[model samples]
Target chain A: MSSNSKDKDNRRRRRSSSLMYQEPPESLEQQSDQAVLPNLNAQWVNAKGAWLIHIIIILLLKIVYDIVPSVTQETSWTLVNITYMFGSYLMFHWVRGIPFEFNAGAYDNLNMWEQIDNEDQYTPAKKFLLAVPICLFLVSTHYTHYDLAYFMINFLATLAVVVPKLPALHRMRLAFLNPEPQPTDQ
Target chain B: MNSSNIGTELPPTAVAFIESAAASFQKIPGSAIVIRYIRSSYQNDPIRSLVELFLFIFAVRYLLAPAYSTKKTKNVHLTEDEIDELVEDWTPEPLAGEQSEWEKLENDRIPVIIGPAAPKTKLQNGRTVTNLASYNHYNFASNPELTAKAVNTVRTYGVGPCSPPGFYGTQDVHMKSEADIAAHLGMPACIIYAQSFSTISSVIPAFSKRGDIIVADKAVNYPIRKGLQISRSTVRWYDHNDMEDLERVLAKVVKEGQGKPLTRRFIVTEGLFENTGDVVNLPKLVELKFKYKFRLILDETWSYGTMGRTGKGVTEHQHVDPNNVDMIIGGLAGCMSSGGGFCASTEEIVEHQRLSAAAYTFSAALPALLATTASETVTILQEEPSIIQNLRENIRAMRAQLDPRSDWVICTSSPENPVMLLVLKEQVVKDRGFSRQEQEFLLQDCVDECLANGVLITRLKSMPPALGSSPRDQEKEWLPRPALKVCVTTGLSKKETEKAGIVIRHAITAVMKGKKWQR
Candidate 1:
């Protein structure tokens, strides 16, 4: 087979695998009403990538502390982690994504996408605040010159996870909700 | 080695990166084989090993994100074209992700008849006092105690709560009604809504929301469907009264959400279905609830005052403990013969509804007089338990002697249920030579004929469209065939009950032959 055809086959396999959970609309409706295109899209497309990064970062730090005795500056890493958590929690939950509880039930007590819309007001401020704590930690700890090894290992690992999810995170469409469809390629 | 079917190869740099990553991932000590060897390694240093296991999981999820087997379901996100097709030719796709927006039920188009007489079926249809077609089974419209309470409340507080519940609209009588209903249901707390229409509609949304899972009966009422829509929760509708189907769905959902503790799951159903006048099997439901750890919400709007030994509803009637069910929502309109709705549950749940429920917060409170009447009705239910007993006996009398032939009229619901439904035979409906609308009109006309013959009966009125009903018998209609609902009241004597059965039987037969039986 031609290399080009093989590449197309590979792409087809990727699409089908990523979408293994999908059924025809009628079957999906029969199975679970909330398990529609919009939610599925929101789940994969707009998933909180920041949260994924945080977990990976924390795991790497813990490995450093456990395996190599983590040279020093423990307090700085802890504080930096704390701020990342706060910023991501607020932004993801309030604006970019929906928590399970808010989206999982028969009737929504929460107003329709009101919180998602309201997310715009203070997110930039919260993001800015997040940077301050990280900057302070770096300033206090003499951030560079310690170890490229740990950073390299964790960064490479996280990129593997984050790269594939990026498309979905950007393009997630909440199926039932009537938001205008946007082109995902951008 | 097997490069013959190779896809377009990546650039050399990308290939080199992939090779190096594979080598590095293999070299990382706990990252590769730790998961497979975890059980054996756990005994070496359980706590440290546990920590290692978690870290390993994190690393693997990150490393294999592309290959991660996520358990999300495939959904048919309709293309714009599919939406257009559905819009033009709306079909019976009950569980279709999007319920057709343009399809209208008979009740949506037809107006309800307003009855005037108390305890008697004297309906006011424009000019003359016609037979009251539907509602308030016992005609408590003229009960002395209820009337006195209404009169006193009107004299004191006037007609309505003009403002919403959060405003100055909450009356003392509303409190009493909530308390009375809570006590009657043997629940810790209760919250009353303005009217029956919004009762289930508001209550279901109060607890459930998007991302949650709700497994309800397919034949649930319209209000429940509306509530489901608002919550945007994942919902699965099991077939009506089919416990096995409910179990299959619950088991599958529990399996799918195996590790997801935060994703709430509930089993929602009606005690006596509004569409079919059938009772749900509560004992079996409680058993399934226990097995699947699903919170149960029983909407007993039709069964509240009519069922049970002392009128404690499905729990009393079915001999199941009430505490097993998490929430109970019902209307006061049934045997109580009042206007309004109440939800009874744990104190915490009721409190949440008070703070979170949109209908309660945003809508006017129940009228003070109506609340007083509801409270009085509860008191009467308890004090004169005979009210429920008499109703049951009347039901028994109606069910016993009224052995309707399959060809004539068949009682579809349980005999113990005070709400008796007499429906046209399926074969007959299919065989009939009329158009779908004409068939509906003829069935409705039979109800009118029954009313003219001194028995106040009504056709199955439209409810808020639930995953509502059955496929049409004759046409491409997506609704249950029209049935005559003869609500047997406690006030009916044995003779009256017999007369009702006779009248209904005669009506259906004569209506089929295209003849009208006069009073």
Candidate 2:
């Protein structure tokens, strides 16, 4: 009898909604990132001799292109410039999140560009990354003898990669070309 | 061998190969430019050329070096034979460390029951004594109806499920028991585990991960502390049962997390503190959980089947809605006379634990008999609220004889609590100048004295700190004060309970005043 009455009382009382207690949902990307340990994908860029490896890679690429049969010096420099810019752009900016699954999707919404130095703009690593391409373009143009076609190709490749690293476009995504995927419910 | 000697004694094939390599180097286009550039860059400075060579070598070495180990140990290279010798020489320490004299004595002194535990239990020594140590508060263990149902279940389903719930082990009896418990607690869903001791420990890590935050009471039970440790979450402790301190800690945590992305935050505490025999302020906890946007994980193991008018647990007793708490973990072993535990929560949480909780997923399911017995016990508690009233009356009778009449000790338990914890008076402890260990010894003496006088009681057992933790790590560990535990049961009449309580009080007085125990 008492339990029956107690059940009635419980039914009469309005069950309090917990929605009021929940915090207003913000960008889940940032929130999920904060929920995990620091990202390791971008951290290697700050390690010892990490910058030197990029120059080594470019030199290796130049040598490889130069050894191709019947390739002129101008064509080799142009090929090196385009290849380096394309690789760097794909590596540093195009890839979203980490390749490793250890972080539990902590960096899923963040590209390597945003993940570098914890998304801090103008870090030393970022500065060196930005300078490498411009210097490469200058060398490629000088080596190409400032021919209009070769100069144009080198300059455009440099511009394509350098604009994304600017602080103004830190987290910007080209929506039409690369639409953000819907967040999967875990 | 010197390089000059090797050059002078070079084989004809090697010389021909070198000559061909040089010829090919000269044949390559831009070879003239590369030589010219090198000559100009060298500019009669050998250091510049040497530095360039060193840079090339350093880059190669850096790329070829093995990945660094995450562990902080130095990389010590050893020959295979040396490693074999080291392996042969190694002797592992014993799994369990050496037991102290007190531990060995306590192990020997443990009373072995000859039959089913009850108000009057026969010990291995062939003596019948009034039992107060077992948590048979309502004495439902020997109920004829429950026993009959259990026997029926065993006859129908055998002794065990022989598999975890995920496989073919989830029997109909288990589902009925889960439904009964969920309905009794007024929660949306419930999930049961095979054992009570590891329930919360498994439930904690299932939801709270490494980077989450947990604010727990300092006096939580051993299982809860272990759960917090296993979760690896950031833990902050507040003073036991102090609502103000809990509020302050919550505010401090919220302040510290400002501008950072929000992580899952939880406030963990117990319904009735098993060590201190006191109840938590549930309304205050719920309010603070809302105020700070933290979820509440309330462990009601000790208070679930013992508190409230209809045995709905602390939420019912304190008039707080069950939905307010995110998770409620309760033991069926304590008062329900069953052999497992349950967590009452929403359907989502219950479904989650079915797949994720370690004990539930890996351990075998509860026996069919225990499941039916738990279901029967929940129904009995709801239908017969007078059983709770009888327990409270026994508690009152026990307290009347022990609390005010005893001059050497005083009861620390709340009035409604059946587990009466009698601690030495503050003044008596101060005058005697007894350390924690000495007080524990005195309490053990009191328990022995009570048993000698035909009353069976126990002491509040304090858990040792976890292994591998340094002494400095235990500086902030909290231990309950030494006290004699007298768990009042409805199995004994009010008069019998009063008589047993008097025996407990006199036993404490005798132990405290005895010349042998005097400092």
- A1-186 in candidate 2: lDDT tens per residue? 454565454333322422222111224444554557767788899999999998999999999998999999888988888999999889888887678644534565567887787777666777778778766764564344545566567768887987887666755566434543332211
Interface RMSD, candidates in the order listed: 16.4, 12.1
Once superposed on the true structure, which residue ranges of model 1 sit more than 4 Å away at CA? A1-186, B1-115, B119-132, B259-262, B397-407, B430-438, B451-454, B463-478, B515-519
* lDDT of residue B267 for candidate 1: 89
Model 2 chain B: weakest 10-residue lDDT segment is B62-71
Deviation (Å) of A176 in candidate 2: 28
lDDT of 1 by residue, A31-114 (tens): 354433344323332245633565566556545554554445543354344444444444433243344533343112222221
Top TM-score hit: 2
Best by lDDT: 2
How accurate locally is residue B62 in candidate 1, as Cα lDDT from 0 to 100? 42
